[model samples]
Each structure stands twice: as C-alpha cells, then as structure tokens.
Target: MTGRRKQGFILFRDVMHVILAIVIIVMVVFAFLSPNKYAIFFPLIFLLFSVSCLLDAIKYFKNEEHLKYSFIKATIMFILFLFMLLMSTIGFLNI
Candidate 1:
C-alpha cells in the first residue's frame, strides 16, 4: 500500500460524499417541486447509494490502518443510510 494509493482512496471517499450530498439535495428539491415524478425515482437512487456506502464502510473497516479518518467515513455512511430510509418512507407514504 503506497501513499499515493491511500491518498487516492481518501480522495475518492471525499468525492463520493460531495456527490451524495448533491444528489440528496437535488432529489429533495425535485420531490417537492414535482411532488409526483421525483417521488418515484428518489427512493431508487437513495437505496442504491445507501447500499454502496454500506459496502464501502465494510471495506474501510477491514483496512484498519486507516483508522484515523474512520469517523468521517462513518458519518458519510450514516447520512447515506438515513437518507435512504427517509426517502423510502416518503415514497411509501406518497403511494
């Protein structure tokens, strides 16, 4: 495990965090604006991201060497998981 690879991994996580935040904001806004079409798609995307985050967290945990930034990773994964649940609930209620 070279330093560059480790840095790349961290950067990738940061990128994923920003992308997920943007996605959630967009979906939430769209959900309110249309209150119809976005309601259908938001849950699907949220579920996908939540699954991805959970898998990534598993991988991070296995690599205990990077424990220093584990908190950030955990926070990001938790947010994704929560967002997924919220969106799913909203979708169910809308129906």
Candidate 2:
C-alpha cells in the first residue's frame, strides 16, 4: 500500500480502538447517571459488544475472512462498530 493509504489505515485502526474503549466508558457513565432504568446493563452490553467487534475484526485480519462470512456476524460487527463510533463521538463532545 502507498504511504498515505497505510497511514490512513493506521489512523482508522487507532480510531476504532478509541471508539471501542470509549463506548464502554460512556455506557458506564450513563448507567450510573441513571441506574433505575438503564442500570449497568447498557454499558456492560456495549462493552461485550465492542469486544465482540474487535474480535471479529481481528479474525478478519488473521483469517482473511471476506464478505462471504455469515451475514449476521458481519452485520453485528459493522453495526456495533458504527454504533459505538457514533455514540462515542456524541458522548465525547457532549460531555
């Protein structure tokens, strides 16, 4: 890959790391902010979800899995990745 492409990929990877970590933190913050309805379940869910996404992402890199993989797996990973990314961005800016 070109230097620029390599750098972009690296940046994206780092961004995902931040997103994954922040998703858990944000959920915890919210859960504590309102333990009655949200409880710790939401944050714990986010944490578990992010871990799964990271694992799937790792699997893709290691095994060269492609679009042919199970749609559910791909969808879960993609949605979690995007959901955490969006929530993290909003949470970071709002708080």
Candidate 3:
C-alpha cells in the first residue's frame, strides 16, 4: 500500500475508535440517567457504527499486502455490537 493510502486507513481507523468511545460513553450515561426511551437508541447506533467499522476492517483484510491494523478494532467492535444488541433486546423484552 502507498503511504498516502496507509495514512488514510489509519486516520479512518482512529476516527472509528473515537466514535466507538464516544458512543459507549453516551450509552452508559443514558443507561444511568434515563433508561426509558433514548437508552435503546444508543445501542442501536452503536451497533450500526460497529458494523461499519467491521466492514472497513474487512476491506483492510482483503488487501493483497494483508494489512491487519484494524482487525483487532473491528473484532472488538463486533463483540461490543453483539453485547449491545443482546442487552437492548433483553431490555425491550422486559418492557
């Protein structure tokens, strides 16, 4: 991969990390402050962003040079997404 393309991928991955952190913080805050309506939305959004990150990671993986920089982040996001989905579903079911 060219230097420019590598830098771009790194930037994208870093941005995703930031987004994941912010969403998780918001998720926790909403879970504590107001668990009625908005709490569920945060998890759904989290799932969405995580899936996007995972797709990006897949792209990175498919490269001929086998860049794996984002692979760990993507896997973490996938795990988090699953957790968020399960909790959200349970919360809704209990409601």
Candidate 4:
C-alpha cells in the first residue's frame, strides 16, 4: 500500500476503535442506569465489533500479513453478531 493509503487505513482503524470504546462505555452505563434497556445495545455492540474485525481482516489482506488470524477472528465476530441479532429479534434477548 502507498503511504497515504496506509495512513488512511490507520486513521480509519483508530476511528473504529474509538467508536467501539464509546459503544462499550455507553452499554455499560445503560446496564447500570437502566437494566431493561441494556439488551437493546447488545446487537449493536456485536455489529460494531464484527465490523471492526472485518476491517482488520481487510487491512491484513492488503498488507499480506496474519491473513488467517484476521479472517478467523472476523468470522467469529460475524457469527456472534448474527446470533445476537437473531436472539434480539426473537425476543430471546429481551431487546
């Protein structure tokens, strides 16, 4: 990757990390302040984490390093995302 592209990817990854952190904080706060609403954020948290993992996988693929690890992690995250989404939609999670 070119220097500029690599920098952009780094910036994007940083932004994702920040967003993920913020989401987790919000989820925790909600869990404490309003237990009933906490489940609402479950799927969203998983989705963000899965997306982050996907971004990492893409970055690894571009750089030709740790491809298997990144892809495997992304796959796991996506599965969790899907499972959470299903549970939420089915009322099993109470979201």
> Please, what is the TM-score per model?
0.56, 0.41, 0.51, 0.61
Root-mean-square deviation per candidate = 4.9, 7.7, 4.9, 3.5
- The candidate maximizing lDDT is 1
Candidates ranked by TM-score: 4, 1, 3, 2
What are the per-residue Cα lDDT tens digits for candidate 1 across 1-95? 68888778778777777877777777778878886676675665666577667657655664756788886887777677777778767766766
Candidate 3 structure quality by residue, lDDT tens digits, 4-92: 98779778777877877687777777767876766566556545565555655555554565455556665665676567667656655
RMSD of 4: 3.5
Error of 1 at 11 (Å): 0.3
The residue-by-residue lDDT of candidate 2 on 6-85, one tens digit each, is 67766776677677677767777778888777753564555456565765665455343355665556666767767865
Taking all chains together, the TM-score of candidate 3 against the true structure is 0.51
Best by the TM-score measure: 4
Please list the residue runs of candidate 1 whose C-alpha ends up more than 4 Å from where it truly belongs after superposition.
48-52, 55-95
Cα lDDT computed for each candidate against the true fold: 0.71, 0.62, 0.64, 0.66
Error of 4 at 47 (Å): 1.6
Candidate 1 lowest-lDDT run of ten: 55-64
User: Candidate 3, clashing residue pairs?
Assistant: none
Cα lDDT for residue 24, candidate 3: 72
